[model samples]
Target: MRVFIGYVSLSGNTEKMAVNIKNRMMAVGCEVYMERLDTVEVDTLKDFDLSFIGLYTWDQEELPYEANEFYEELVQADPQGVKVALFGAGDWSQPRPCGAIDIVSNKMKSCGFAVYDRVLKIDQEAPAPDRIRQCEDFADRALSWGSKRKKWRFFIWNRMQNNPKYQRTAYLLRRALDDYPIK
Candidate 1:
């Protein structure tokens, strides 16, 4: 499956987590596209079968500046039907640790992305063995979701292609499906 990972990291904590997520997904035979949140276009979300968003919590439980912008753009980008998973890095000792992950996950849900509840939160800037395992588990679940969605899409496409009236719609859907083929 095709996956996209967009993340923001001020001190590389979130970046490290993002890399771990990428590696895990790649290990599962997924085609992953990793990009910094500041550089990624929100509209590109539609091109992937699954998405992982990672960020660090800023002051007052707010999203980091770049991630805040990315959130706004995501809300306006029509992300309906996209599959999403969230992760964040922060000091648990802080009053509001990993708050950005909650914020992004909720917003993505509100925008119609099929967001899962298994969010990964890392304490401090270091990765533990448990955290790495969590990342792998997260990848496995995301891959499973993508696989199911692909099957459903194929079912719908097959049905539509059988009806002459929906041939045009089926063709366009086929193109979109081509961009994110299931493995």
Candidate 2:
């Protein structure tokens, strides 16, 4: 499996989470690519079977300045059927903790990527052992969900293709399946 991890960390907190996720996925035999979001191209997302974005919520729950361009490009890009998992580190004492995660997750969904439901949100800077474990578990769940989704889509497509009456239904069903977040 191919995986892409894009992250923006001003304080190194989210970077630690991204690294943990990348290492876990790579250990599982996945071809993992990790880069800062500023250097990542939205067009390249289609090449990966799974992707993760790590970002911290800025003041007043805004996305960091570095992520604005990527977010805009993602909004403009066509749907590519890539599955994305979101993770981040933020101060729990803030009024809107990890707000960027919600923003990015919603955008990814609106742009037609299959999003994983289990988002990793760590409190503050340093990632403890438990947070690292959460990152690994998040990676595992994403791989498992992608594997099952692939099989399910293939089976449904093949069955529906053989019957012309169900072709349109199949298309709609596939879209719904892609849009739905995997648990």
User: What are the Cα lDDT values of the candidates?
Assistant: 0.81, 0.83
- lDDT string for model 2 (27-135, tens) is 7667899999999788788888788889998997899989999999987776667778899989898888999999988988888878888888899854479878988
**Candidate 2 residue pairs in clash (backbone atoms < 3 Å):** none
Per-model TM values vs. the true structure: 0.77, 0.78
Q: What is the lDDT for 117 in model 1?
A: 77
At residue 152, candidate 1 shows an lDDT of 50
Encode model 1's per-residue lDDT on 27-122: one tens digit a residue.
655688999989988888889888888899988798899876788787678776687888878888888789888988888888888897788888
**What's the CA RMSD of model 2 in angstroms?**
10.6
